[model samples]
Every structure is written in structure tokens, then in C-alpha cells.
Target chain A: MNILVCISHVPDTTAKINFTADGSALDPAGVQFVINPYDEFGLTKALHIKEAQGATITVLNVGGPETEPTLRKALAIGADQAVRINATPTDAITVAKSIKNHIQANAYDLIICGQESIDYNGQQVPAMLAALLDVPMVNACVGLTIDGSTATAKAEIDGGHATYTANLPMVIGGKKGLVEEKDLRIPNMRGIMTARTKPLSVEEGLSGSNTAAKAFRKPAAKSAVKMVAPDQVNELVRLLHEESKSI
Target chain B: MILVFVESWNNQFKKASFEAVSYARKWADMAGCSVKAVVSSGASNPESLAQYGADSIATLDLAATGPGMAGQLSTMMDGVQGVVVAGTAVGKTLAPTLAALIDGALSTNTTSTPSSVGPVVVERGAFSSKGIETIALSEGMPIVSFVPNAIGIEEKAGAGAIESGSASGTDKVAVSEVSVASGKVALPEAEVVVSAGRGLKGPENWGMIEELAEVLGAATACSKPVSDIGWRPHSEHVGQTGIQVNPNLYIAIGISGAIQHLAGVSASKTIVAINTDPEAPFFKAADYGIVGDAFDVVPRLIEELRAFKAAN
Candidate 1:
């Protein structure tokens, strides 16, 4: 079986997020970039499938050259090959369209992607890819298993979980529960050396107009906390009910 | 007409559905149009929607056929200028499918209402609510998914004309079983939430958290570490990689408030943190705070809340 994993490059979770001088874009001056945390879970799951089911995992990303390091990191983690779509992902539709075009040219039995990128948190690409490809897609999936042409997955719903079954040529938006932290493999010296020589391909993608961000702003700063002494707990309840009217 | 998709589960309108109707009403008023609500669960209270400014309600009986709510709603999108929906579990899947089907521009988890003029524009959280971006869509029609609680629910009386519709069925996927979390309020709809972290020490100590939540009628949540260790169900996890909640009040107990955890609760209107360590990062983001152990703080708070309620 052949598997495709889509990844994104985002700032580290601990990185302090700031805006540019004009407040139009993210201030990348001191932010440290890393593979999106959720995407790492996707890659880890893909590697598990590669190890257990003997499938070739190809990592894909839709971005410019700055994303190559992230893709190479996926290779080190255990993807058989890497492919970078030479485009700036301005919006979800553009990224999905380009991925759809690429997938149409290449065949894969299963497609995997993180539930949502940490940066945008849009959670659009996986569904859009499913729509454009005319395939079944499961979002917020925690467990995925493939057997021959049938795939059974468990996904989180409104109040509980629901199990779903779909045929091959499907998409899955994976989250943390897909694999535990201990299962995630880090790149060793040997794996790092091998990743440097692994096949990484770059290809052009389709062109399309998408929604543009006109401006950027920060959320209002939180106010100073009203601290109540530990002993005066009932005062807190009165304040919440009368002053805030929140309870 | 601005179409708002009202999501229902087990034949009732979710809280997000009311907020969606209210949000669409704002846009409709700005555009001098009307708001039409489309219900996907095949059952609805048109009166409830009418109170929230829905001019008409279209009920699609897709529950029996199963899993085609998006396809059915796509048929109703003809000539609709703008589409609105709640960012609920089902809406997360349905809106994108509908937008792709109609070749419309889609924006998810929008924090601000778009201006009612042409070339639809809105503000959405980017980088996990760390920054906000003002987006403009000039392509096909615009579809916006309002984050849960992004817009407050309000009542504006309207003529509640009800219409019934149906769509053809396809058995691509079947839901084998559903076990709804009964009795407890779901996190997304809860106005008040009490979430705990490792400071409580073990799963056995969850009684106090539940007691506090029970006293305040709030939902219970946990930090990623607590869930990761299996002390709490994954559904209770709220953070960057976990479920995102936007409640009116979020009380974090024993949580140090990692950035990832803050990313999820930052949208909450008021935050109160109770931690033994005074310097826990969560204090920086809280509206109210207490420096004490959960064992000492939670029980007392719960008792105080009960007393306050009795007095009222």
C-alpha cells in the first residue's frame, strides 16, 4: 500500500506570537519554526503504518523553500520520500486544489493529514481535499486501521465518538490520540544522515485566487486579576454572581 | 437571503445553532435582507428560531437517510448571497463540503461578524488565537463558520415560516452506534467551565472538580497532561491540540497554563485560576485568581457557591 501524509510548517507552540510593525502579518523575526505539532502526530501515525503494514509513506507540503527543512524532518522520522509543491499556501482552497491536482497525477491508497494546522487552525484542507477528490474524509479521527480495501476509523463527534468505515482512497484528519507520545520516533544519527540523501522532489501547482487577509490585530490584553484572599471564598461567589453575572 | 445552517443532535437545536441564527441576523440586517435557517436533524422548533430573527426555517429530513446533510443543504444554496453556520462538530464537516460543492469562499472559526457589504470581510483567529487576521473574500459566495460563542445569542421576533425538504440518500458510510454523554453539559455549550490539571495529583481527586462543576452547573475539562496520562477522557482535553472551548467563564485549577492550553481558553470571557503556585503562568491570563491548593480551594468554593445559591 502507498500512503501520503501532508504536513505544515508552523511556529513552535511555545513561541511568542507577535505582529509586524504595520500589523499586517506575523512577525517572524524571533519566532522559531517547527513542524506543526498536530502534523507531527500525523507523521508518527504514517510511520507506524509504514513499519507495521509495509507501506511506502510519501510526505507532502504546500509551501515555498522555507518549508523544506520541515519536510526533511518528516523524511528523517520515516517517510520514504518527500515532495514539496512550489507555492505559497495563501488559503485553504489553493492548498487543497494544488494537492488534489498532485494526487490526481499520483496514486495513493490512503491520505493522512493533521486535524488542523496550529497556525491558521482553519481545519479546511482535509475536507476540501476530500470534496475535490470525491472521497470519504473523517475529521478529528483518533484511531485508523486499514485492511485490504476497507478502512475503519473512530472519530470524536459532538458528545461522544462514532465509528466509521470507508473504502480505500480516503482521507483522515488525525489528532493526538491517533498515537501516543512514546510511539513517536525521533531521528537518530543514522536516520538523519540517510534523510539528507533521501529523494525530495519539487513540483509546480495550479493557480487560483483565494481570500486574502486585509489586516491583522491582536486580542485585547487581559485586565489585572482581582485577587480574593483564600479565606474569603464566599466573596468570590458573590462577585461572580452579582458583579460578573456569570454564574 | 442569508442562509444559516442550524445544527441539531438527537432532534434538538444546539447552543451554537442559536448563536448562528443570531449571527446571520446581524448580517441580514446589515444587507437589508432576511435570515433563513436550515435545520439538518429533520426536527426543529421554528418558534425558537423565529425569536432569534430567522425569517423562515427549512427542515431537511436527512436523519433517517444518514450522513448527507451537507449534500442536502447544497441543493438549497441556489441564489443565496451569504451562508452562515455554527462551528460545531457536524458543522465543521458540513460547511466545508457545502462551500466546496458551490465553489464558494470558506472561512472557519471566525471570531468577528463580517460587514454586510459586498466582498465579504471578517476577522478570524490565526496561529491558534495568538493573532487575528482580517480576511476579504471576493470569489464566489462567502460562507462563514462562527466559532461557538463568538456571537452572543439574542432574541429578535420574526415571522417563522416553516418549510420541509428531503434529499435522496446514499449509503457510503453508516454510523454503527452513538453513545451521547448524557446528563452532563457538553463543553462547547457550557457557559461556565471548570478545568483541572496535574496539580490535582490523580484521577481519584476528580470528585472535587465534578462537585464544583455540579454546584455551578458548569462543564468539566482538563489540561492535555491530565488527559494524556489517562486520568481524564480525551474529550475533556482542551488546548491547542485538544478541543477548543469558548465559554463565558473558565476556571483553571492546578493548571500552570502552558501556552498551548491558553490557546484554547483565551477566547473565554473571564478566566479564574486557582493554583498553589502563585507564579503559575495561568495567573497572567486570568481575570480572578487564588493562590491555594485545589484540595483547599475547590471544596470551599463549591460550598460557597451552594450557600450563595441558597441565599439567592
Candidate 2:
């Protein structure tokens, strides 16, 4: 079986988020970039399946030259090869189209991606890709197993969980617990050096996209925290009812 | 015409759907157009859609039509100027598909009403939660999905008409079976949540967390490590890669808050951290902090809550 994993290059979780002078784009001046944490689960799960079921994993990303370091990290981890659609992913549709272009040529048995990229948090890419490919897709997959030609997966729903069984050529958006963080295989020195020699294909991005971020601003600061003493339960209830009106 | 997809499960309109309807109604009123709600299940009560300001409700029987439900929804969007859906998982899937099918743009997770722009101008989160972005969709008949719990649900008096529709054929995708986890409240829908981490020691000690959650009418969640160690179900994991929740209250017990964990719950309205470690990073983000041992403090906290409840 051939598996494809989608990865995103994002600011390290610890990095301070700052805006540019004009506040139009993210200010990545001194921020450290890493593979999106959510995507790590996708890559790790694919590697586990590859090791257990003899499947090959190919990592894909849509970003510019800066994303190559993260792509190489994916290769070091366990991907057999990597593809970089050289483009600044502007919107969900453009990113989906880019992935679809690669998927059209290669018949992947399974495509796995993070539920959402930590950078943009635009959780639409996986569903959009599945729609473009016209294949069955599951989101927030927490557990997965393969039985012969069918793949059974458990997806985290709003209140409960839903189990889905789909044939080959299905897409899954992974959340936490799909694979343990300890199970992540970090490539050794040799693997890292050799990953540079592996295939790192790049293609032109689609143009003429209409969706663009017109302006960016910060959410208004939340009101000052009102401390209701532990003994003020009735007061809290009254405030919630009459003042906050939340109830 | 503007279309609103009123999401319902088990024959009840979700609170998020009410929020969506309120948004759709506001937009429709501004655009001088009629708003109609569509539901996938025929079992849904169409009358409830009117209370939230929908002018009409259309129930499409798609149990037989399978997973091409998006295509069917797109067919309904044929004459509509715009479509509004709750930015839940289902809407996340359907809205983009409908947009792609119509060759239009989709603005997802919008927080506010559109500006006076031609298509629509809306605000969406960008760069994690670091910033908000204002985007204008110029494409005709844009599809927009509002983030769940982002907008408040309001009610308006209305006597809307109900229409029934059916789609031919069966869904290509079939839900072979549903294995629902036995829990009092779903994590995503819970207004309050109590989560634990490695600070709780073993899975057996989870009784305290569960007790506190039960007292507060909140769902139980665990950090990634707890889920990784199989102490808690993966469905209960909350983090960057897990389910993001924005409940009214989030109580972190014994969890030395990690940034990944904070990312999931930061949207929560009030955060209360109870940990033995005073220097835990969660204290900086929490609205209330109690520096004490969980084993010693949790029981007392529960006792206090029970006593407080009885008095109230």
C-alpha cells in the first residue's frame, strides 16, 4: 500500500507571534519554524503503518523554499520520498488543488493529514481535498486499523465517537493519539544526510486565486477577569443571571 | 434567497445551529432576501427553525442519497445568493464542497456579519489565534461557515413555512455502524470541561477528575500524554492536534499546562488551574489558580462544591 501524508511548516509553538510593520502578514523575523505539531501525528501514524504493513509513505506540502527544511525533517523521520508544491498556500482551495494535482498522477491507497494546521487553523483542507478527489474521507480520526482491503477508523465526533469503514483510497484527518509521540521515529545522522539526496520535487503554484486576506487585526481583549470568591456562589449566580445574562 | 443549513442530530437543533440561524437571518435581512434552512434528516422538527429567524425550512431526505449530500446541497444553492453553515465538522465538509462545485469562494469560520461588500466581507481567525483577518469574497454566491460557539444564539419570533424535499438514489458512503462512547456529555458540546494530565498519576486516580466533572456537569478530558499512555480514551484528548474546545469554564487538574494543551483550551472563557506546582505555565493563562496538591485539594474542592450546591 502507498500512503501520502500532508505536512505544514509552522512557527514553533513557543515562538512569539508578531505582525509585520504594516500588520498585513506574520512577522517571522526571528521566529523558529518547525513541522506543525498536528502533522507530526499524521507523519508518525503513516510511518507506523508503513513499518507494520510494508506500505511506503510519501510526504507532501505546499509552501515556498523555506518549507524545505521541514520537508527534509519528514524525510528523515520515515517518508520514502517527498514532494514540495512550491507555492505560498494562499487559501484552502489553492492548497487542495495543488495536492489534488499530485494525487491525480499517483494512486495513493490512503491519504492522511492533520486535522488542522497550527498556523492558520483552517480545518478545511482535508475535506476540500477529499471532495476534489471525490473519495470517502474521515476527520479527527483517533484510532485506525486495516483489515484486508478495508480500513476501519474511529473519528472523534462532537459528543461521541463514530467508527467508519472505508475501502482503499480513502482520506483521514488525524488528531492526537493516532500514534504516540514516543513512537515517532527520528531519522539518524545517516538518514538525515541521505534525505537530502532523496527526491524533493517542486512544482509551480496555481495563480488567479480570488480569496485573499484583505486586512488583519487582533481580537478585542476580553473584559477584565471578575473574581467571585468561593463563598459568593449566590452572588455569582445572580451576576450571571442579571448582569452577565449568560444563563 | 439565502440558505441556512440547520444542523441537528437525534432530532434536535444544535445550539451552534441556532447561532448559525441568527447569523443567516441577520445577513438575509440586510440583503433583503428570504432565508431558508435545510436539514439532512427528515425527522427534524422544522418548526424550531423558525424560532431562530429562518423564514422557511427544507428537509432533504438523504439517508438513501449517501455521502454525495454536498452535491445535493449544492443543487439547493442553485438560486441562492449565499449559503451559511455552522463551522462544525459537517459544515466544514459540506461548505467547501459546495463552493468548489459552484466555482465560488468559501469564507470559513467567519465571526461577524459581512460588510457592505458585494459578495460579503467577514472576519476569520488567522495565524493560529494570534490575529483576525478580514476577507472579502468577490465570487458570486459565496459559501460561509461560522465558527461554532463564536457567535451567541439569539431568538426572534417568526412563523416560517416548512418544505419537504427528497433526493433520489442512495448515499455513496454508508455509515456501516456507529460506536458511540458512553459519556454523560459530549466533549465538544460541553459548556464546562475538566481535564487531567500526568499530574494525576495513574488511570485509577481518574475517579477524582470524573467526580469533579460530574459535579460541574462538564465532560472529562485528558492531555496527550494521558491519552498516549492509554489512561484515557483518545477521544478525550484535548490539544493542538486534538479536539479544540471553547467551553465557558475549563478546569485543569494536576496538568502542568503545556503550550500544545493551552492552544486547545485557550479559547475557553474561564480557565481554572489546580496544580501542586505554582510555577506551572498554566497559571499565567488561567483565570483562577490554586497552588495545592490534587490528591489533597480535589476532594476538598469537590466537597466545597457539593456543599455550595446544596446551600444554593
Candidate 3:
């Protein structure tokens, strides 16, 4: 089996979000970048698949040269190879098309990526990529098992979850439940040394975004808490009903 | 006309369906267009859409998978300039695929109505609610997913005429089974949410939390550690890595509030925190806070709420 994992470079969840002076783009200054936490689960699941069954895993990212570090981390964790599409992703549509272009040029049996990047949280690329390729795509996937040429996957819905079956050459958008947090791999010294020798390829990517961000505005700052004594349960209820009108 | 994709399960229209139809109506009025509500199949309360703004109802056997539905919707465009879908799990999966299939512009999880019609312009939450972004779409057909509970439900009284259409069933990614809890309130549409964390000690103490939720008509959620340790199901977990919830009021009990957890819920209109430690980080972001043990405070709060409900 050949699996391709799509990695996204995003700000750490704890980092403060700030935009440029023009309010048109994100300000990367002083922001720490990391592999989007969601994609880590998918990559770990791919490594497990490769370990159990004979398979080769290729980690892919669509960004400028800055994203190579994240792709190398995926390699250090246990991917066999890496590919970098040399383009800054402008929108979900542009990124999906770029990935589709790469997938057409190279064949892979299974594709994996996070449901959404933490920074944008659009949750668009995987489904859009599947549409562009005219293939099956499953998002919010928590459980997945492969049998021969078929893949059985479990995805979360509104009230519960649903199970689905799809053939190979499909895409999966995995999240935390795909693998236990404890099972995620860390780069050991030997693994990091080996990853430095692994193959890393770069290719020009397609451009043009359907939607363009015009401005960025910050949410209003939260006010200090209005504390009520622990014993004042009635007063709290009264405030919730009379003052806030929330109840 | 604006096409609104309304999703349904177990022969009932989901709460998100009403919100989408209502938003489509408002957008249609602003854009000077008519509204059509499209259902995949098996919606028992299709007429309720008329209470919102759907002028007509078009029922089709929409293929269950995103790719399949995108293919079906491509053929049904029929001079429609755009479509509006709820930002539910199903709608988010389908909107982008449909946009890609038809070579249209796409926007998901939009918080506001588009400021312009053709070459639509709108604002959406970005950076996990830390920032609001304005996006402009110049593509011919614009597809958008309106976030659940972001817009208020309105009544416009549509004609609600029903039209039937055939299905182009795509066999890819066939749904083998679906399991949904019967009466639980879904996190997305909940107006109020009651959440607990490891500070509650164990799952055995969840009865009080559930009681509080029941009295408030709220959904029950948990922090990451509570779910990780098997004290609560993963579905209830809300954090940067878990589900993001934007309820009108959020009540956090026994949670110390890590940055990741705050990212998922900071969008809430009001937040109340109950924790044993005064120095818990959640208090910094909450509108109201109480420094006390959950076991001591929750039962009393539940009793107060019940009495308050009786008098009202």
C-alpha cells in the first residue's frame, strides 16, 4: 500500500493570533509554527498501517520553504519520504487543486489529512480534493481499518457516529480518536539522524484562489469575572435571569 | 433563486436545517432572489421550512457521500447563482465538494450575511474565533455554509410547494451503519452548554452535572483530560483538538482552562466558571466565576434553577 499524508503548517494552539498592519494577512512574527495537531494523528495512523502491513508512506505539504521543517518532522516520526509543493496556499480551493495536481502525477492508494487546519478551521481541502479527483472522501474519521482493497471507516456526526465502506484510492480526514494521544511518536536521536538522509522533493504548485481575505478583525477582549460567593446560589440564579437574561 | 440544502436524520429536520433555511431567506431578501429548500430525503417536518423562508421544497434522493451529492447538485444548478447549507458535519463535507465540482467559490462557517451579492463579500470567524476575517468571492457561483446558531431564526412564511426529483446514487463511500442517541441535545445547536473536567474527580459524579444540564436544557461537554481518561466520551470533549462549540452561554465546572480548551469556547457570548482554585486560568476569561468545589456548588445551583423554573 502507498499512503500520502497531507501536513499543514499552523500556529501553535496557545500562540496569540495577530494580523498584519493592513489587516489582510497573518503576522508570522514572533509566532511559533508547528505541525497542525490534527494531522499528527493521521500521520501516526499511517505509520501504524505501514508497520502492520507492508506499505510506504509519503508526507506531503503545500507551502513555501518554511514548511519543510514540519515535513521533516513527519519524516522523523516515521514517514518513508516527503514532498513539498512550492507555493503558499492562498485558499482551500487553490490548495486542494494543487494537491490534486500532485496526486494525478503520482499514484497513491490512500490519502490522509486533517479535517481542518487550526488557524482557518474551514474544513474544506479534503472534501474539495476528493471532488476535484471524483473520488470518495470521508471527514471527521475516528476509526479506520483496511481489508484487502477496501477500507472501513468511522466518522462522527451530529448526535453520534456513522460507519462507511470505501475502496482504495480514497481520502480520509482523521482527528484525535484515530489514534490515542499516548501513541503519537516522538523523534528519537536515531530517527532524526535517519530522517536527515531521507528523500525530500519539491515541485512548483498551481495558483489562484476563489476567495480572498479582505480584512482581519480581533474579537472584543473579555471582561474580568464578576465573582459571586459560593453560597450565593440564589443570587447567581437571579443575576442569570434578571441581569443577563440568559436563563 | 437561492438553493438551501437542509439535512435530516431519522425522518426529522435537524436544528441546523431551520437555521440554514432562515439564513437563506434573509440573504435571498437582501439579494432580491427567491428561496428553495432542498432536502436529500426523509424529512418529516418539511413544512416547518415554510415558517422560515423556503418558498419551495425540492426533495431528491441525494447520494449520502459528499462526492456523490456534489455530482448531483452540479446538474441541478439551473440558473441558481448560489447555495446555502448549514455548517454541520454533513454540510461542511458537501459544500466545498459542490463548489469544486461546479468550479464555484466556496465559504464555510460564515458568521455573517454577505455584504454584497454578485462577487459576494462576507465575514467569517478565523484563527479559532480569535479573529474575524472578511472574504470576497468573485467566482460565478458562490457556495456557502452558514454556521449553526450564528444567525437568529426568522419567520417569513414561504409557499412550501413540494417538488420530487430522482436520484443519481453514487456508490462510493456507502454508509454501512449510523448510531445516534435518541434525545440528547447536540453540542452545535445548544443555546447553553454545561461542561466538566478532571477536577470533578470521576465519572461517578457526573449525575449532578447531568442534572444541572437537564434543568437548563443544555448540552453536556467535557474537557480533554476528562475524555482522555475515559471519564467522558470523546464526543463530549471540547478543545482545540476536539469539537469547537459556540453556545450562547457556557458553564465550565472544575476546568482549569488551558489555552487549547479556551480556543474552542471563547466565542461564547457568556461564560461562567466554577472551580475549587481561585487561580484557575478559566476565571480570567469568564464573565462570572465562583471559587468552590463542584460537589458543593452544583447541587445547590441545580436546586436554585429548578425552583426558579417553577416560579417562572
Best by DockQ: 3
| TM-scores for the candidates | 0.97, 0.91, 0.98
Ranking by TM-score: 3, 1, 2
lDDT of 1 by residue, B31-87 (tens): 888899887645546568999999988776663212356677677776688999788
Could you give the candidate ranking by DockQ, starting with the highest? Answer: 3, 1, 2
* Candidate 2 true-interface contact recovery: 0.45
Candidate 3 lDDT tens digits, B75-134: 889968679988888888889888888888888879888898867888888888888988
Model 2's number of clashes is 6
Colliding residue pairs in candidate 1: A119-B127
What does candidate 1's lDDT look like per residue over A1-247, in tens digits? 8899999989999888988889878888898888887778888988888778889999999999989999888898888999999988888888998999999999999999998999988888888888888888888888888888898888888778888888989988888878876677788888888999999999997667558778888898998888888888888887788777788
Ranking by lDDT: 3, 1, 2
After the best TM-score superposition of candidate 2, give how far the Cα of residue B157 lies from its true spot, in angstroms: 2.6
RMSD of 3: 1.3
Name the 10 consecutive residues with the lowest summed lDDT in model 2 chain A.
Answer: A224-233
Least well predicted 10-residue stretch by lDDT in candidate 3 chain A:
A238-247
RMSD (Cα, Å) for all candidates, in order, is 1.5, 2.9, 1.3
Candidate 3 Cα deviation (angstroms), residue B141: 1.4
Runs in model 2 deviating more than 4 A are A147-149, A219-247, B63-67, B115-117, B168-170, B307-312
Q: Give the DockQ-based CAPRI class for model 2.
A: acceptable
> In CAPRI terms, where does candidate 3 land?
high
